[model samples]
Target: MTRRPVPEYAPDRLTAYEVPLRTGDALRTPHDIAAILRTVHTGTHIYLRDKVGTVMGTTLFTGDPATVTPAPFTNDDWSLTLLRCLASPSTEELPEARLCGFLFLAPDRLRLYLATEEAPSGMTAAGVRPGGALTALLAALPALLDEQRLTTTDADDPHCARVVDLTDW
Candidate 1:
């Protein structure tokens, strides 16, 4: 089958949300997001919403972090990555969901822009499949933000205190 062209990144088309980072939350870097992606496993449950607020629930599987890719554009102040995911509908009435979106990480918030169509083969060939991973991450963000302050090593060392290593226990 012929494929549709991948649209260029457009900030206007994206919907932005403040990630609600608490005063001492350690989830302040793109590395933290990568760590979260690395932690996702198969059969993770996710709840998704479309532009109009329709909820689509599903369970998804993911490949390794190598499958996740950096977006084409660059912003010195933000971290931008693309996560491609396929959602198998939880109910028969709904169709399968193909999520090809950009997750932009700023120091204080996250900006998400989900394409309305399927991802191009060139993009999906890497196969990161972050549907469940991202959903689980966002769903647990509040708790994660709240719990980060408890993981620091030195309260007096600013850099050391802000370091959060989610890759390990």
Candidate 2:
């Protein structure tokens, strides 16, 4: 995959609450998110970008950025694709939804963080098919953000709280 840069998002600046109101079950904490990410096949990484075009840091999933088997992908590659997707316009008549940034894990794993100029009828970051950029990200992620903390990531774990929410979405 081509390399790209995923921007850094300041959770404080996030005001785009256009998310669909699903059971809080889906919204994962860092540990939970990390778990889901680990489920993906090795040699990949997962990242979450918010609706306001803010990029969070690279999710601390598996081994160090250095010595992972197969050499895990760098955030830069996935980040650029996400940015392009966010900047692209949607042809679909998703009247209630709009494309924001994306979750950059790898091939079959990702999340499509949505945004609405106004309040949303509900909060949902659905997996949407992309038109301009690669749609793999949209296809990879689950429809709803569910709970399930890291298998090893304890609530007491320093990165636990920060893992799922990552300080903030």
Candidate 3:
């Protein structure tokens, strides 16, 4: 069943981040989240470990951005968006997951949304991390673009905020 779109943000509390990303090519086949997991996820994990701290799993989204109503912003087309939560700082110690982020690639740009609910605290901390997904995405982008993965035209970053943005519709 198609998951109904859920409200990811509240008007009273608005928080968003514009991840400055240097775009490359696409990362995987459009809408093929499974394929991305097989090829990019595992490899990207290493980079995330070195850059953004650590992540346990991810959620994927595909289709018209309009389907996601009341969005912070919109894009013409969007495919294979990935969302993951930043887990504990170290594997040895367990703590509440503080931050979460979303990643999506358009034909010409890469957009990242780090939820603001939990202030900027963790491995990657704040702003953009060099060795984080940014680095791994650079390597993975071309592969997706080469495959002509799905993308949007005249796309604008949504600047998503809230755990729902990373975990729900």
List model 1 lDDT by residue over 1-169, tens digit each. Answer: 9998655444433433222232265433554444434344223434333312211322223322344332322332222232321233345653322333333234323322322223222221111222234555534432442354433343543322122222222
- Over 81-103, each residue of candidate 2 has an lDDT whose tens digit, in order, gives 55554555355544333555455
Better of 1 and 2 by lDDT: 2
Top candidate, metric TM-score: 2
CA lDDT, every prediction? Answer: 0.32, 0.37, 0.30
lDDT of model 1 at residue 57? 24
Of the pair 2 and 3, which is ahead by lDDT? Answer: 2
What is the C-alpha lDDT profile of model 3 across 44-142, one tens digit per residue?
222322223212222222222222122221232222222222322335643233334434343423344333323343221122222324334433432
Worst 10 residues of 2 by lDDT: 159-168
Candidate 1, TM-score vs. the true structure?
A: 0.20
Per-residue lDDT, model 1, residue 78, is 25
For every model shown, what is its TM-score relative to the native structure? 0.20, 0.24, 0.18
Residue 44 displacement in candidate 3 (angstroms): 30
- Clash pairs, candidate 3, are 25-141, 26-141, 26-144, 26-145, 27-144
Where model 3 places Cα greater than 4 Å from the true spot, the runs are: 1-99, 107-109, 115-169
For model 2, the local distance difference test gives: 0.37
